[model samples]
Each structure stands twice: as C-alpha cells, then as structure tokens.
Target: MNNVEITRAGLPDISRIVEIENNLFPDPWNEQAFRDVLFYYSNTFFTLKSDGDIVGFITAGIEDTSEVLYGHIMNLAVVPEYRKMGLGGRLMQRMEYEFIVSGAEGSQLEVRVSNGDAISFYKKLGYSQVMVIGGYYNNGEDAVLMMKWF
Candidate 1:
C-alpha cells in the first residue's frame, strides 16, 4: 500500500473520479453531478489518491441550522482493486475530519437498503440507521438513511 493522500478534487480529476464511480457502484453519478461537486462544492468534495490514482473518494455538503451545522455525505466509492486496504476508512476519516473542522455537528448518508456490505461498513464507523425512504432510487429500490455525530 502506498501513501494514501486525501485531497479536494480539481477539474482535471473529474473524469477519473467518474470512472471510479462507474466501476464501484451499480448506479453511478452522472457527469453533471461530478462537475457540480467540483465546480460548486469543491471545498467539501474530496478524492483519495494512491500513487497518483484515485483509489477512493467522497463528496459532502454543509447544512446550517439555527444553532449548529451538519455535513451530508452524498456519495462514496473505493476502486475494487483498492478495497480492504483501509482506503475506505481513510476517505471516511478525512470526510469526518472536515465535518468537524467546519463546525458540523453530525454527518449523514443514504445507502441502498439491500447493500449489506455498505450497511456494515457504516455501522462500524458509528453510523446508526435513522430512517428509510421508500422507492428512493430510480428503479424504485428502497434506501436507508444513516447518521453519526462527531
């Protein structure tokens, strides 16, 4: 395993990130969503680089309330070749750190209801199931909303 570098994604990294997305998820983010993450929310969108390759990545945004702020993890993926090497953990840790530094009181994400592996991962990371949304995906699959507080 090489040094895992977590950094914000630049315009040039968009294509590779999209490739990672397509390789990792059954339904991946579209090009415009990737562009939005970089162009509009670059500060919170991040990628994990190993030997100059995008091995893992995550995107998030801040939500403000009257008394505090929160962070929402929009998407996360780790290249199949890079899985089980702590790359996913590294990416999540980086995102949580950013949330804390940005005064976010909590973090949230929604996962495919049937994705047991991801559910377990989030559970180990201290995220607890909060709710479920019916027919959340384009194919009418359900989704589970999970959350954790820093």
Candidate 2:
C-alpha cells in the first residue's frame, strides 16, 4: 500500500528483477531466464513500482491443454523491505484479475514446502493445496502445489 503501481515489465527491467531475484531466492533465475520470459511471456509479466523503483514483480502465463485453459503463476517476489505490507496480495490479485479477464478457469502455483508464510498467504487468497511434489526444487526442497478456481 505504499503507492505501488503495477505495470507490464520490459527488457529494461530485467536487470533490476535479476538483482532482486538473486537476493531473495537460493535458486534464483538468471538474466537469461528473465529475458526469455519477458520475450515470450511478456503479456503476463508485471512489475510493482514505488516512487519509480521496482519493489516487486509477478510472472504468470496461460496454460492451455486438453480443452482447458488456466493461469500459472511462475514466480512472484517482493523486496525484503517491502514484504508483509499487503503488496504480495495486491500483486496476486492483479494477476488473478488478468487471468479472469483472459477466460482462465483458475490459477495455479507451486510454493516451497518449507515456506510456511507463503503457503499461508496463498491460502488467504483462496488457494488450496492440491498435492506435494518431491524434490521440486533444485535444492531438493519439496513443493506444495496450490490452485484457486475462479
């Protein structure tokens, strides 16, 4: 709620996104990965800005298969200083809104099993745990798959 603005991210924002990713995650996505997403999945990529600085971002995509289409949240992150301020929820809501507008039936994401806070946050947004995947992360951490039906 710090006057945050959500906007589509572009190539110019990848460096800053990479910086935040490296600082926040143990197995961070590199510049090339960001570049790939921005280039191929630009429509679903968004950045949260505050006073002209990038404070957070969410990367999502539409998955269409078997006559069903749904949204997939690939990554979501906010700077440590900006956490717990409802920014994460706002970002998610914004993405969900987009998904709803795009004819998506629901949204899905995977959270690290050890990330209790994130699991709770997703639960607060009406996401339910569907299952657990073993060794989902490169670091050997399990992941809890969560889904929300629109």
Best by lDDT: 2
Task: State every prediction's TM-score relative to the real structure.
Answer: 0.95, 0.97
22-119: candidate 1 lDDT, tens digit per residue: 87777889888999877877888888998888777889888888787989999999877888877788788888898999999999999999999999
Q: Residue 121 CA error for candidate 1 (Å)?
A: 0.3
In model 2, the worst 10-residue window by lDDT is 1-10
Across residues 1-150, which tens digit of lDDT does each residue of candidate 2 receive?
456799999989999999999999999999999999998889899999998799999999999987888999999999988998889998999999999999999999999999999999999999999999999999999999999999
* Worst lDDT 10-window in candidate 1: 79-88
lDDT of each: 0.88, 0.94
lDDT of 2 at 51: 85
TM-score of candidate 1 versus the correct structure, residues matched by position: 0.95
Q: After aligning candidate 1 to the native by TM-score, how far in Å is the CA of 66 from where it should be?
A: 3.3
Best by TM-score: 2
